[model samples]
Target: MPMTSHRAALQAWLEAMPFRREAVAHLMAAQEAVYLVGGSVRDALLGRHGYDLDVVTEGSAMALGRRLADALRGAFFVMDREHDVARVVVRQGEAHYHVDLAGLRAKEIEGDLRARDFTINAMAVPLRPGLGELLDPTGGLDDLRRRVLRAAYEGAFRDDPVRIIRGVRMAGAFGLHWQPETEALALATVEALRGVSPERLRDELFNILALPSAASALEHPVGQRTLPLILLLDPLDLEGALEPVRLLEQALAGAVWVGAPYGEALEGYLRQTLSVGRERRQLLKLAALHLGCGAAAPQKAEETARHLRLSRREGIHLRLALQALDDPLWRAESEPEPLSIYRYYRQVGEAGVSGALLALWAWPKGSTGERMARRAHRIIAAWFTQKGTLVEPAPLLSGQEIVRKFGLTPGPQIGALLEALREAQAAGQVHDRAEAWHYLKRLIEKGLS
Candidate 1:
């Protein structure tokens, strides 16, 4: 798309948003000099929805924030005095809109542009009346057209090493190539990344991985440099060093669980792979231990689960994936019986079963793995429909119930009995409260004898 047309469309879109337009008008009328800046402009130029809009001005960010709050009836927050950034959050029932105002430290617009990480982001659109021109003093438009990432200034990395990850993220997000000089600077900035806080590093790594093209960037030479830096920060000697690119490829290509546990694991992987810190490494270990059901042996799965502090739901997902991995034929056969389907559901809960099926579908074709995954999805779907529900059976008795009914002391034996009962119920050996009670009674009697 032509830059002129792209800018026109973006202007139209921004003008259409009554609230944003009003906010811009409020800032402009004050004569403090404000311009729409940062990611919002970058994303708009790229023809994407920009969620957060940032504005830079010569006026006090806190003062502008208060004025905007009063005009829009929004809540204002003074973010940081050091940075001179303030946020105004405007809410209209379910919808939320954010407007940020920041102070400009530079003498000229070029100085502000030079302070940004990349050329594309350095470009800004002036909101002042008759000043609608895109101020691209740093050849941002040229770099954007070339789909090349370039540092705004030579000392950009020295000022903020987190830009290394941001560069990778933008490359993946925009499918842009880093300029040779930019690539060199990224490498030079690697050591500086160590000086950044772990939380900031963690956020950047995850944001990069979450991008659709992240898998490809992971394999890139620039992406590879991230690995050693991570290891240096948080050393972990596995049986062997994991190929970071290949691992990301597998993860991106595979069906990902988008739950709390999965999120935790992804964060952990980024941190551990990057060697973020000991606390982060431990979090990743926990997440990996609970990733897939049946992917590992039962004993190993249990051990890993205990070690990593996985929740019940996470443990269930890991176990189900492991189980699906074990029975290649379960997913290979064209038509699986009800019993097989029931067994699959029994092992993995509904979400886990769905996750397993997705993993199978993601398997590359012309391999036994692909065929197995295809067949597994077919069988699982058929059984799920036949049952009209794929809910995992609830435990017939609770731990407290076991204590009350078995006349057993409050100890480890109570847990053993409850687990045994649940297994029996899952195996279809026991049904209803009466059967559960009788079974527990027999186990308690046998133990006493």
Candidate 2:
């Protein structure tokens, strides 16, 4: 659709949202001049709605935010007291709307728009009766129409270097192109990005990783130029890393659980929350990307995490994911069989499979690599079918029972024996407790004790 049509359609559709009316009424009651600003305006004009809403007001932003929070029965937080920026989180069932209230940067809305980082996000709309008209002094609407991301000013990046990261992320997320001038400005100011707060950098990097076509975007010129600079300490070979990320995405794209009992469980496990809003899948893919280059993956991952200020769990997952690539087992020509898979599962639990699969995907797509890939896929599918047995099993014999029956003292031998029993159970050797006891007795009789 043309940009003009999108704008018209979104404008027509905007008034129908129930929250707008409630929000406008509450803000108007406070007698503050509030304008729906930033991404909310941009998204609404692009035919998307009900995401987070950013609002700028002439009066105290925190005061109005508290009022709106109370009116909407939401939780409120003061983001920046000096800037009078506050946030209210409104929950509706499973969905959440974050309404950000900030004092106007300038006396007028146009000046406020000019001070913004990107033109596409500089537009605004009044939060009052009739909702007034769309405010686009910086030609944000035109940029949005062109699918071009333009900076409001050349100094935008210098003012807030985080915008450089955000610019690439936005381009990737929205299929946006950097306007010529904006691209040049960004390139010139790229070095400043390294000095930004680790927390801010981490947030933006995670946003890119969370995207569906993250690798493609990172391979884009802007991302290609900036990403390595951001993680300059341990530069990424993005070309080498794309394959596994693409494969992981493909694996998770469909109704992966169809006809598989553990499909849902496996999907849920991969999607499990890690630290600081990072997911297991994100960290695993990150590990794959880092491991693609060469050795020193663990050190590289640690340095990257430290620079980005990633959470402890995120760092640990990355290190674990690299294990498969680093281990000699996967480097062999022959593919890992069921026993090897069970051994790997015991070695690292869930992360072991994820890492092994990433390694197989990253391999060259020839006869050997194809064989390994197929083997990995089959092993994963079979594991999913028997995930219950793989994850946990009822112990056939207890340590106390072994000690009492065999006259063996508590020591490393006991732990080793139990682990062996568990492995046997995993490999279908021991079914019943009697069978397990018999198996143990045979081992003892064979002088294995």
Candidate 3:
């Protein structure tokens, strides 16, 4: 089905759905007016299916929530008081739908719309019979049609400075431009973001950077400055410090799902690039800096890994990519040895290596770069498939093993030895129990002598 037809069908289905209809009936029967508001209405108009539904009422949100919970047998969580919002979680098959019920303090719908953050989100569709119409008192539909973001009021930013980041996120997500007034509001409110909590600011920053068009949005001078400053609480006055961030954003844009590896990489990159005192920025920077470099240079790769604060596992990936890029032998082969490929699996762990390979393949490149990346990918795949499949190799020596074998007491040395052995095993030096014993024996003997 076409996008438009699908959306229209969904809208019709939602309107007729038992849950929505029941909620509408309950609200009206209780003498309270309700409207299907926010993202659901906005997305339906934009020809998209909204996963979450937000309902606003003119009366008691708690009372409405309990009533709806009883009707639908859904779980009700009265999570907030200041906003008078209650959350209902309803399950359908594997997907869970969230319905938010909010009580309005305003005397009229127009006043309620004016209290919202952005014009596009300020529109509401009434759920009652005579009021079952779009009460877009703020011209949100026009803003949506124009693909522009506008603040609902002058005080909107003052109410919540975090909305500025949200505006950037929306602009990136929908490919919309901010209105001139909205842009000015965002710029002026940039300083007010200092008042927001660090954790909230961190979350908003991650959301913005994780978007596909995040790169394009970050390329905007104002956005670049604003985002970094929000994170660091200090200014980054560089002309183009956001260039790498843009590259990362664009590279990750096509991903169907952004998982742990992506999050780890992004977190590391932001910490280093932003110079924020949050935690382990240097480590994230190291991982990100070596992101696109294929098996190029071993010494440089190791150094880069050390600089970026990568764990032993991450360092192995950097080493493998560097080695592959530098390998004239791999380039010479119509098919590289299974051993060489097994080494790749052994070194980086399969998931990390595979993720690195995909990153290399997706890295912005010309014709030659593309061909090399494709060839490298094929070689890596073939090697893994031909081999008996990579399994996470168990440590040859544990802390207990170290204590038992070496007659060592519990101490930092035991921990340090265990770590060394694990790194050696990952690097493929010690293949078995005997090798591990001998390696430890030799280290002990050398140090004692």
Candidate 4:
């Protein structure tokens, strides 16, 4: 792994991955000074498999992005029209990845690398074979060799404080030691984070939480480097919530499983994306982070969710997980009955999946630990296996039925009753149409009373 060979190795790594050659080949056709830059270069050097390809070109980056999309059979988006940033996204079956192409920030590759955040990310290789040698103007190669993380310049964090979060994440992700000055600089710039957009802060936080070391790094025994960011969470009780995250990350990373039987379901539960494509695992951590926050967890979850600009689905998932951290199963020394489990799921809906993990991991493993494990296992199994029967029974009473039968207007009451009936059905009190009608009638009577 000599410095020269890094470029050659990256060229081969590009060929092996799905999108690289097609993107580089198309960009090479442009006669622009196309170079593989940023993490696309760093990750390849470390032999880490990465789906993202970062490219900078002398020509219009957006135009090249559209052409690369056409060449790679992907979709192109003008991610930042004013900033001359564009993205090409490609889907590979169940998973999707992207390439971001941007016009050079500076006049040349050397200047562009100098303006980047970190030395390791500041290295680049020409996209066209034999066009040039590996470019390392800022000692990125030396930093990588020393396994040390360093800011590209003194003002890197000041320029974009979100890089501080990214710096911590990369440190955890690659196990790179912080050059003391870089760490000091990043810490000094924490207040500047307030000026950063909520979206940028959020995406970087997500990236940080996605790391296997996220929980420990954020709450490290020595000191939590991310405490400044956590304090921004205010009353959410986000601090000291890493236990659930620790467990969740372990399962997601295949370091542990919820048990062999429900392994697939548990993985899917953690991996599934919300409507806005944000990860459930990250939101789960946020929900449980406030477990110590008690009554404030739900409100804090909602407030923080709004600040993060999470999708409606994502917000509900986070808020609900916090809302219902305590459950019958977690309380009971024995596994709760199906009806209890059904009620729990009914209360939180889809957040039940996340809440279950939070509860399971946060459950202590002493004395009755085995029972709680069994309880968690059964509850999670029901979510994937028996949800149709015991958890979310097919609704017998539709909203249309309520409006027609009850002579009621299409309003809040109808919606409330319809949702309640699903839980009632789970209670096994309403098995058939006749029983469902009687159950609704009793509910209406009870409401009027």
Best by lDDT: 4
Question: Candidate 4, which segments miss by more than 4 Å at Cα?
Answer: 1-4, 90-97, 129-131, 220-231, 234-239, 251-261, 395-449
The whole-model lDDT of each prediction reads 0.63, 0.75, 0.61, 0.76
lDDT of 3 by residue, 1-449 (tens): 12354235335647755565555566556667787777777876776664577888888888888888777678999978888989888776776777898888488778888899999899887766533667787888888888988898888888898888888888888778989988887787788876777667656665665554555765554576565455342232334434544544444444522443244444343344223333222222223334333233345546544543434654565455445444442344344444444554445443333333434433457855455555555444443333333223466667887788778889888877765665566456777889988888887887731
Tens-place lDDT per residue, model 1, 37-150, is 877777767767644678898788788889889998999998898989899999877778898888896976668877999888898887777337788878887888899999
lDDT value for model 4: 0.76
Ranking by TM-score: 2, 4, 1, 3
Provide the TM-score for each candidate, comma-separated.
0.71, 0.91, 0.66, 0.84
> Global lDDT for candidate 2?
0.75
Worst 10 residues of 4 by lDDT: 220-229
lDDT of 2 by residue, 386-441 (tens): 56564345687899999899999988877878877777777788888898898888
| Per-residue C-alpha lDDT of model 4 across residues 184-206, encoded as one tens digit per residue | 88778777877878888778878
Every model: Cα RMSD to truth: 7.6, 2.6, 8.6, 4.0
- Looking at model 1, report the run of 10 residues with the lowest lDDT sum: 233-242
State the TM-score for model 4.
Answer: 0.84
Which parts of model 1 have CA positions greater than 4 angstroms off? 2-7, 231-362, 365-368, 371-392, 398-410, 441-449
